[model samples]
Target: MTEHRCPVMIVTSMPYRLAVIFLAGLMALLAGTLVARDAHAQPPHADPAWTDIVVGAGDDGRRLSLTEGHRLVIQLPANPSAGYLWQIEQLDTAIVARQWSSEPDYVGPGDEITGGATQQVLRFVALGEGQTTLQLALRREWESEAPPVGVFTLNLQTVGPFTGANYQYTVPPLTQPPALSPDDIYAEGLPTHFSWCEQGKCTPIRDQGMCGSCWAFATTGVMEAVIKIQDGVERDLSEQYLVSCNTHNWGCSGGYWAHDYHQNRVPPNEPDAGAVFEVEFPYQAKDVPCGAPHTHHEKISSWSHVGGYGLPSVAAIKQAIYAYGPVSVGVCASDAFGSYKGGIFTTDESSKCTGANHAVVLVGWDDGQGIWYLRNSWGTRWGEGGTMRIGYGVSRVGWNASYVVYGQTPYMPIGGATQPRVRLFLPAIARGGGGVAPDAAPVPTPTPVPTPTPTPQPVQQVPSNGGFEDGRVIWSESSQKGWPLIMNTGSLVIAPHQGSWASWLGGDHNEVAALTQSVQVPSASPYLTYWYWINSADSCGKDVARVLVNGTQVDTYDLCAARNTGGWQSRGVNLGAYVGQTVPLQISVTPRGPVDLATVRRFAELAFEVVGLDYRDYVVQDARFVRPADVDLLVGDPRKAKEVLGWEATTSFEDLVRIMVEAELSNPENA
Candidate 1:
């Protein structure tokens, strides 16, 4: 294992006094604290008779049967150095148990080294015979308010015990391809090359990973580049928004870009649909349900194919790029294309490169060299920094080319004037089997034997009117502006999760609604389950729903950028620790205005500029942490800072960012 050293905190170029103050601010904001662990690092229940089953990425949604006392090991691909970690997000503890004692096995060379690819391993022991689900999220700990970058869910069924030898498995270490110089391709006596991408202007190349969502990436790529060209603004649109929310086409499994954008509009309300910001719905590289976060979208006026279904001429494609910025094109991505590192890519084998299936973007072309510049969804490590130069017409480079026309006007917000209503439909709860009638009149008397009332068992007691069926009879309800907490049949779209009524948390801006109930925690089954659905036009951080027990926050839901739950979805909370004690359970929601994506983009750009780094580095790429929402952020006043530190910001935000980057690069450790 390599020694893990923290990045040296170095502040240079600026005056010593200002540098000291800046360094202090950086230390306060960039501590990079690790996340807390709920589970132990040691194996909880070690037994010689126990068996083990190992699983890894792509094993999500698997249904596995495990005997009691057996353990299931999940090993997910992770890069801790990249500031992302995989942790258990959800688990049915009644069915499976985890402890903190078991240490995970590090399967890569640079175990704690920066920028190392590592594996996150978690072990769960089957508790008893029951069905449960296990969910894990890959994310940066500091970005707790943001959605996970990746998710894995598994369904587990524990069966009768049967002792077997613990399975032993080996995970292969991750490796990178040999570095190939782009100079090798430039030296090949190629013709003059022309590109539309200006330094720090073009949209950054993105990675599609193991998913087949290249079509969505291609569409967003062209749209983003065109927006930069036409509006002089850099926007990072959500490709995952189309991959998950666009129902007209399949997500991840594969679909055409035209079908995703042109055919599918934002649903449940919004019609002027296009692409949303990447922060709203981060890509999971899987088939996720259409969540509510996608409702806030950027509307495009129109899009059209450059040429018909047939292959387009190189000149036509070039003209489209010159007019609209970049043209989305389809091509056959064969093994040769996949293995491409450098040099002009061309293949003569038709059988290998069959139909124009995979989608990519054509950014520029050189007629003299008979080559076209294409941007791909693979990571920067692939090809030449996620770009390819190919002979015109090679690999079906110009097939099904298309471009997006700029929107004539700014799009109105989705969900109209007021925030989208939190509509729910809960079925009526039915109480069955009053009691089993005693051996129906054994004597055959004219009067039938009355059903015997069975003695009630000491099972966990649910809170009275827990489902809101009694309309707040046993709960305390309060809200701003006298809005009712319990919503009863106000509209056709409004209903309950399981009854005719449900708790409506928030609607409209500047509203704080809350519902609370006092209940003695059940000892037998201490888990409390409830259903909730959120519909909001608010942005994250500004608007949130918090769950509390005994006045302490237990869970919190950021309303903005949250998955709408489609309908009411069940969530569980274990009150086992407070068993037999009466506690106040509350759900409070506060809705506010959304954080503008445009504003966020501008902030990121300015901040990068302050540090003297390229704004493109912050604008188009994924962040290791979620930024503070507009409402939650406090801009520092240079005057106040000057009074305290005897100095004020003297340069542009870009210069500050550049200075930080330069200082880090100048460090001897980096060398």
Candidate 2:
């Protein structure tokens, strides 16, 4: 306004002033936007103090402490399609603020079923330093007057500001037993029958569910029993911590006791290096990513093979069980083995012996009955209240016998508290008045047993075409008029994960395709296992894949979220609950929006072409990048290459792109 300059100068200055004002406004807008975003954002994923509480993993009635600004994630099973949805019944907003809740994008085999059982994931943040209670109810909205089918409650305490501190509780050490001479150690004689379980020294039987994590259960069971016997205190160590946190062991897919016990650490016997408590890390029965800054509550001083490799002698196993509380051993766990309800289980030629496929604990022995008492992980409904009697040499009952001596130091939470223990009562045994015969010559324990068994019922097999290799012989399909989306054996475009055939369910928009088969579930440990691949062109919630049992949705896959499977993923569903019933198993795919078969095909071809592979081969057999890492910003600079390596590209940009596409297609990873 004060400018009184030449006409040309005045015009130039006006434009300059306008530019400055425009830049200032933009700066102010950006600053305000950033402040608002920061205000509403939740804690970053990198936050070390975030806690994830998995419901049904024994998280109920537990009190948890968190510092202000920390996050808590609660996962609960839900079936919204069946009119059962989870809702917050009560929450103290003054102390804790609800962020948001949504359904998970992917359902794994552990939770997969036909009954539409999915997970509802909720997140909350501590707002102020105070105490509060979080409660949720699962019920139908229309039936508000009725009681909820399930309820979940958690006690939460929000401490002051975040202070990165190790909150630890020191376990009062027990009085060490006096060392004895060799003669004194051998003074005691073995008994005719010995059972830590009968003496109330054993932990409750745990159900591994559909997971093949018997090794972890067996390991933790022995640890719990030993802790009780040595310290005169019962402890429920976490099988999940061993399953998930141990890098040397495969979670839920079977593992070796030697590897988990000895090789889990770098140098062996690392301080505070052992399994956490069950309440701190509950059993999920599936692979979960190991969390950061994990704390161990117990450790083992030593573990060794009882009889030095192969099948140990029955006497050595008995001695180990007597001296070491409980011992872990590998078993065959055949279909017949699961069906052994009572009496000594013995194997015949029809049993089809393979090798040790499952792990269990040899809790005791009854020499009079010529049987060994084995504790199982198949829940209280199986065998004799989650235990069974096997003849000394049956089903490789004592192969790979190993015992662990617990470390004297046990850890507790910062509050100097231990989680409450849940005890399981075993069913009473009906014994005859006559006792067993005296100890006989020690014999080698049984060798390995047959595998792929189910719960205790007669083997009611899955559909003959469960793998989808016989075309559609035993399977039925339904789809839209033009899209025939079902299992394929003829298409070279999408190869099967295994044999010569597999199911291909989605291609067109606004289309629904499903495959169905009837399967008879066994009475015990019945489960269905299959492999699947997801190649989706659409994002999450736009296209969906689902598994239904008897017309009820049990599992669902969000196309976009599951796209990262990269290749065939094995999934299983437990059918033990549906014993003796033949139910329909259905896999269905529904695509929404304006997409067509041609578009889907084109997208797939383009994606696979870059790797020089057919879509099926790239997905099923040739996954180049197992998991691609993310970078916030990545840019290609030809100048850097020229300056650093003194190299210049001769190929044209267009031709380079074409060559890259061909190279990627022919790559072995995409073969």
Candidate 3:
């Protein structure tokens, strides 16, 4: 219009201007994306007032004011496949409140199998004005002897207002995977039926009595899933362990599936959950207070939240179950749910099962049936024999689901690095296998023995091919029920006292095995010599081997309580009495203790029942008509002790335990 400026400079500037505008817009878009990512790196309630402590920072102690909270960000070097886990061992809730914990953010240097790590932000708020200590431990939950890898202790205080605000803090930007859409995960295909139970990866069905402790069972289910998915090991995790120790839930009064799954939970007088076996902490219907933590067999490293507590997508729920093993979910249990048996249950949309009242395990899903599988805790007598099937579109079940991770490395809280599992491949062959396997060394067959020329040889070898050097040639070995003794044990460590090959006579209690051979000692001084080893190994073991010569027992030996690698023992007997005679020689070994799991478990149960026996009524009244004075004599033992040895007993053994326990109950401080 201005007749214009068609100059060469103006013509080129148009394209340049457009390029500049495009670049500016692209940069702004990238900047916004980075900012959004950084915002999510921190916990939902990250406050400047809260102090940050890197988990492995060798934190000795710290102080906090009653008016502020603190964050303990742990960058755990985790490998769940190894069954390692981290847990909060000690924390006094009387002085501090474990506010929340975020889902683990896994970050690998490259890939998962090669190397990877996890980041977790655990938030804690000081409750009242007092001093307390927080402790952490890392270990494998399933092992009985696996020691903790390390421990982290943080001494704290809330006695006064802020004093030292000079410690500058820096938070590492979290390396987190992007929020995944369920739709994206399911774009390919969904399995018809995917139950961990079908794969033999789930634990046995358990009952929760009359208490509404579905949440505890759900927690254990997820834990079992984690163990199975990560390590391909199906462990019967203790639901009773969580029911008694996890204080975050209301015990038998109930717990929530969506609540923090053990962020600050600690075992009483112990280090962590899964510390005790189910047999040790049997489940009872009542809301009993926690018992003293004993020898724990399982442990966990940390746990995570899936889709959070509210408004989670069903797609996300399904994706989580696929990625992690099983998931703990919340469902609205209604009148219909109480009577639900076997069938695909779809809540009548007009009247739905509404109210987040029950918790269960989201073990699997079926696209054909359009339902999700729920493993219930109401015993095998109810529902689909302890499992339920629900519709897919239902919102209640997907609302809030969680997952936990396992840890194999041990934690040394005093600032020690994690170590590989110590009890690797240490399964006790005595558990079920008939014969014990060699502990360390593997034994193969030795060189075969050839027959000598038929000369006037006075004595044939006492144990011809005893070491199985020629593969069960002369010695015939058999166990209870005609099971063959393990003749393939070629381990030098477990070999005969003399040779490299040895036979193993191993089984549960009450099972007997024998090795016999016929020898013609047709000469003077017919001496018998052999090498043998025996071990009871476990509390349930009572192994024994006997030397029987011609139906007469010459000597007997008892098995030690463990793998007796103390070298084989040698024994020799002079057979000069039976010179120029042929006799039957037999070596019989028998497992005279508990035979199976049921039998082994009975001993512990019997001990517990015996300890809990209440015989107080006998002290005041006579119920037995025969030999009642023995009871009286037991009642008068204190007087007798006073007369003899000047014992002047303070109390009887039973009375001492009862009185001590009573005194502790009256005054908890004594405990």
Candidate 4:
């Protein structure tokens, strides 16, 4: 027992040492766990602890918050007067983030920063835990008239358990760095400005979706503009005829300019007979023989090709601009430009010139800096807000390289000898009123007076306040903001083939009827013709819809015969042709195939007074297919349509669905 006790005592020191070591290790582990838990609990960059403030134009500064792991996103309107500068700062002490001044600064063109208003996005991450204050500072760089400077500031505070998902990252800021100083041009620049001019336009090769018809789009765009300036009236030349009927060139895929011009002899003054009336074939990326004859004849005031020598210099370009508004030009393919928004240039690296690419117009040049301003076709989102300025003199990016220019020549000018007026062929008059007589005249009748006149009840007039009623009525300027009450009972809807409704099909029938909530047509005039769209299963025949205008039946149509199916289909119908005069428009459907009648769909847009209005306005409005909420979110904050347009949703989604269902159920065919 004594020996065992002694042995245990000897080992006791070791056990004590081991216990101390284990205790220390345990303490270290506990400390690490605590630190990790603290780290895990931290919120995202936009957490209240990391936030500052929120501010916008005409908006009060307010506190904003971020849930854990999320950040905050802010949008600001671009202001050039103040160099388009927008800043966000931490209220504690430091300037956490600032646009323009910060790294990767974005400085737009002086004009953009001043006169052209655009959208700008800014993002911030939560820095830490607790309440954080944010401050916003905006400066207008263009207010040179008033002390040359104006500043606006807003402050906000936010609390956050921030998550990263809450905020979108702002694009790295752009800097309006000066272009490289000009140098002398070399022989390599010959192709750049072969036909350069200050005022010239370039029409992009229209991507006739799915149709390998870039050649036709290019040809038509140039010719259409040419004809317009020549005739003093804008004419929509036909690409279909060029693609289909031109004999010497490939129908689709790629074709040269000379081949298209020579092979396709566009007739003059007969646009409707040859060009406008031709039906568009389904656009296909691969070449297909011109399948069918265009209903309209090809028309041209005059056509010629003018080839020139080496690239035109800046002076030459300026002269062209002074002479003509804009001229079209062609340049080498610089990049994989799926689309572009600004002016044209010859450089391969668009990133250097503010992201410009192929096919554009040289609208004007600034003599002060020798910069060539180009216009692009990709709407208005690309380039310097859809325009670009390139260095002119030294052939920067090959501006002096060989290029093609198209404009109205002396022979093509309005009222020139070569120009001819278009003559329309009206349809033969038909008998009406049950053929009672060929020319019935009113019989002479004697007027009777002095009969006991009953006291006439006083006619009451409702005060003519500017508001829309639920029932169908002619659109008035007062009700311009309301939803359109007219319905498309026609066979097709005309929209940019790229529009959202291009593929929209109604229920099972080849007809679709959307809620006529608060849409407005161009005007209330009965003579206005509107375009609509439809599709067919086969090329032979397709029934689109049954239309009733003011309780009278309208003709049915085979959609395939009238429009292209693979691309957007457009058909214009004179509403005045139906119901003897334009009145309440109602539409229904009857099916042509085994598909559900209710599932058939189509799209449409109204064209009011098609004569004088620019088609661009209609195209722009029709192309905007964003949902109402989306439009409001993008266009402006606190959208004013409710007050300005007097628009409000009178029907709910459930109610709309119910009405559709009831309509379907009421139809014996659907049942």
User: How does each model score on TM-score?
Assistant: 0.34, 0.33, 0.33, 0.26
RMSD to the hidden true structure, all candidates: 31.3, 31.7, 34.5, 28.7
| Residue 200 in candidate 4, Cα distance off native in Å | 14
> Candidate 1, 193: how far from true, in Å?
4.5
* Model 4: lDDT of residue 12: 6
**Which candidate would rank higher by lDDT, 1 or 4?**
1
Give the alpha carbon lDDT tens digit for every residue of 1-671 in model 2.
33111101000011111100000000010010000001122332323455554445269778988765456777676533123456678888767765532222213222111112445455677766788999888765444577997898899998887342312111111111121122211112354456888878888888775566777888888888877877788787777766676656466555667334433463233344666787877888778866534566556787878877667767677777776668988765433455556554644211222345567889887643346899987777667787887766565667678888665432211222433232111111123763222222222223233222222222225554454444555555565424333334343233333344444554544445555555666553354434444444344545555555543444455565323333333233434435576666656655422221122223443555565644433322111211121111111224445668877566543345567677776799988
Clashes of each: 32, 18, 30, 109
Model 2 scores worst on lDDT over the 10 consecutive residues at 20-29
Q: Write one digit per residue (lDDT tens) for candidate 4, span 411-446.
A: 212222332122111111224643212233322222
Local accuracy of candidate 3 as per-residue lDDT tens digits, 263-366 = 33555586543435567777775566677765655456666677566535655666566655688776644324555666656432212223344567888776
Q: 1-671 in candidate 1: lDDT tens per residue?
A: 32121111111001111100000000000010001111111223444454678898878899998886567888887643233567668887766765322243334422111122446566777656678889888865444577898999999998855332232111111111111122211221111244767434478889776566777888888778767766778988887877776756556545665433633455554444666788878888777876764445554567778777656665566556655567788775433465567655644212222345467888887542336888987768677887887765565666678777765322112123333222111111123633212222122213223223233223224566554555646556555536455544442133332334544455534445555555567565554444344443334445556555554444455554332322222234444446676665656654322221123334444555555654442233212122211111112223434567777345544455567667867899998
Q: How many backbone clashes does candidate 4 have?
A: 109
- Which of candidates 3 and 4 reaches a greater lDDT? 3
lDDT of each: 0.51, 0.50, 0.45, 0.30
